[model samples]
Target: MPNINILTVDDSVSMRLLLRAALTKEGHQINEAEDGVAAAEWLEHHQPDLVITDINMPRMDGFGLIEHIRAQPRFRDMPILVLTTESTAEKKARARAAGATGWIVKPFDPDQLNSVIRRVAH
Candidate 1:
């Protein structure tokens, strides 16, 4: 597997910690942000191999972040996995339309998270 750098954006500190731990255990270097705005700021200085963001966040939501990333030429093709408590079909549809590479419903399982990352991080 390649050495992966992942940026995880979520408002919940515990969620971010959990994701960081899981990803780190899988040998990924993880960068964390409390919200989409912070994630965007971090992206300005660093480009991670992948982005994993929560759909619900203060300042900017996952869809907004996806739009922001897509608007940037440098990050246009960056893979993004949206994590959300929302499992509605409409929500998933919106996510796909926003250019998210995949979706992970909240309270994600560590093994499943790793699997998704490995599958999407190419």
Candidate 2:
């Protein structure tokens, strides 16, 4: 698979580190953000091939970030995957409505995560 640039947003430092390690091993460049607010700031200057984010965060949540990204013409079609511990159908629907391309629960499998990234980003 071709290397892709990814912006990963999560409040948990450990989760961010784990994602960084896993994605880096798959040859994807990753930019980390502590929350949706930080991710939005980063998005102002950079464009990534895909975005993976956790829903529950301070300042701004994943839904807000997704809406923000979609509001921008340049990022409207960018693949956004929600990675959160919340697994309710209502939450998933809300995420989809907010323009998330896919959803993955937390404690994600590295192989599966990479596979999903490939499927959506490419």
Candidate 3:
């Protein structure tokens, strides 16, 4: 797959670092934000091929971010993947309703994550 730009939103510094390392290894450029608020601010100036976000976060959660992104015409079609430890059906449904393109449980497998990224981002 061709290299793509990706924005990852999560509160954990280690999670962001892990994602950056894994995605960067696949030749994808990774940008990170500590929370949805930061991600939204970043989105104001930059557009990435895909976005991976955790569901629960301080100062605007993933759902809010997804809704915010969808409200903008420019980012309506951007692929958004929810990556969180929550795997409840309710949460997944809510995320889908919020305009998430897909969901992946936390402690994700790098290969599977990259595969999903390729499928949705391409």
Candidate 4:
């Protein structure tokens, strides 16, 4: 697969680190953000191939970020994957409604994550 640039957002420092290590190992460029607010700032200056964000974050939850990104014409079709612990059908439906391209529950496997990124990164 070609090199993919990924922006990963999560409130946990540990989770971000893990994702960084894993995705970097897969040869993808990763930009880490502690929350939606930080991710939004990064998004304004840089456009990644995909966004992997977690819900229930402070400052601006994943849902808010998805809506914000979707509102901007430039990012309307960008692929966004909700990488959170919430697995309820309701949450999934809401994420889809907000323009998420896919969903991956937390505690994600490194291989699966990389595979999913490849699939959605296009």
TM-scores for every candidate against the unseen true structure = 0.96, 0.98, 0.98, 0.96
Q: Give residue 108's error in model 1 in angstroms.
A: 1.0
Identify the leading candidate in terms of lDDT. 2
lDDT of 4 by residue, 31-89 (tens): 99999999999999998889999999999999999999999898976899999999999
- Candidate 2: how large is its RMSD? 0.6
- What is the C-alpha local distance difference test score of candidate 3? 0.94
Against the unseen true structure, what C-alpha lDDT does each candidate score? Answer: 0.90, 0.95, 0.94, 0.92
lDDT of 2 by residue, 1-122 (tens): 89999999999999999999999999999999999899999999999999999999999999999999999999988999999999999999999999999999977999999999889886
Candidate 1: where are CA atoms >4 Å away? none
Query: Which tens-of-lDDT digit does each residue in 55-91 have in candidate 1?
Result: 9898999999998988889887789999989999998
Q: What global local distance difference test value does model 4 have?
A: 0.92
Cα-based lDDT at residue 2, candidate 1: 84
lDDT pick, better of 1 and 4: 4
Q: Candidate 4: misplaced stretches above 4 Å?
A: none
Clashing residue pairs found in predicted model 3: none
